[model samples]
Target: MATLFVITLIATAIGSISGLVSGGYDGLFLGASTGLVAGVAAWAVALMVAQWRRERRLNRYFSQDGPVAQHVRQNQRS
Candidate 1:
């Protein structure tokens, strides 16, 4: 999350610089704003994907034949 935010900031700055070079004041502001929005959206998507993968990994550990579950059963018998 933090990494993504940092990336977004960097992207926004780059966009602003590019716009300034290519056009002028109007381009600079517009590019910066557009970059910011795009960055945030990208961050959100990354966060969601990370969360989904984590959930999937956790669920695997909880499955009947998973190592964690097998360990639990052995401990119970002991």
Candidate 2:
């Protein structure tokens, strides 16, 4: 997504600048690599958390005590 791409770019820029300031060419590569990995991990975690929350909400909505279930029960008696 756009959010993930933006996060990755920001992280890479930060890492590259820091490495350039502290060390040299080698440090730049190392910092960029580390930043990329961190960005992807963060994105993955965000996706998982979103999915979990969605599933939880759906489960609650469809449960026996939920509105849908109540409506179904009402129709059954008619």
Candidate 3:
């Protein structure tokens, strides 16, 4: 969440500055809006990827061939 905010702020600042330099007031608004959308999209994609990776890791950890499963099997044999 914090990272998302930071990314949005940086993108908006960059867009606003560029727009101000190229097209004045109107450009600033357009650039800021575009930047905001892009930032949010980027953040969403990043979040999804992070979630997917975490789920994959957790699945692996709990799978039959995983360390936890092996430990349980060894304990049962004893």
lDDT of 1: 0.90
Better of 2 and 3 by TM-score: 2
Q: TM-score of model 1 relative to the true fold?
A: 0.81
Against the unseen true structure, what C-alpha lDDT does each candidate score? 0.90, 0.88, 0.90
TM-score on alpha carbons, each prediction: 0.81, 0.89, 0.83
- On residues 1-78, what C-alpha lDDT tens digit does candidate 2 reach at each position? 789879988888888878877779988988888888888888888889989999999999999999999999999999
Mark the regions of model 1 whose C-alpha exceeds 4 Å error after superposition: 71-78
Candidate 2's C-alpha runs over 4 A off are none
Those runs of model 3 whose alpha carbons end farther than 4 Å from true positions after fitting are: 72-78
lDDT of 3 by residue, 1-78 (tens): 898889988888888888888899999998888888888888899899999999999999999999999999999999
* Deviation from native of the Cα of residue 69 in model 2, angstroms: 0.9
Q: In candidate 3, where is summed lDDT lowest over 10 consecutive residues?
A: 33-42
All predictions: root-mean-square deviation over Cα?
A: 1.8, 1.1, 1.7
lDDT of 3 at 32: 88
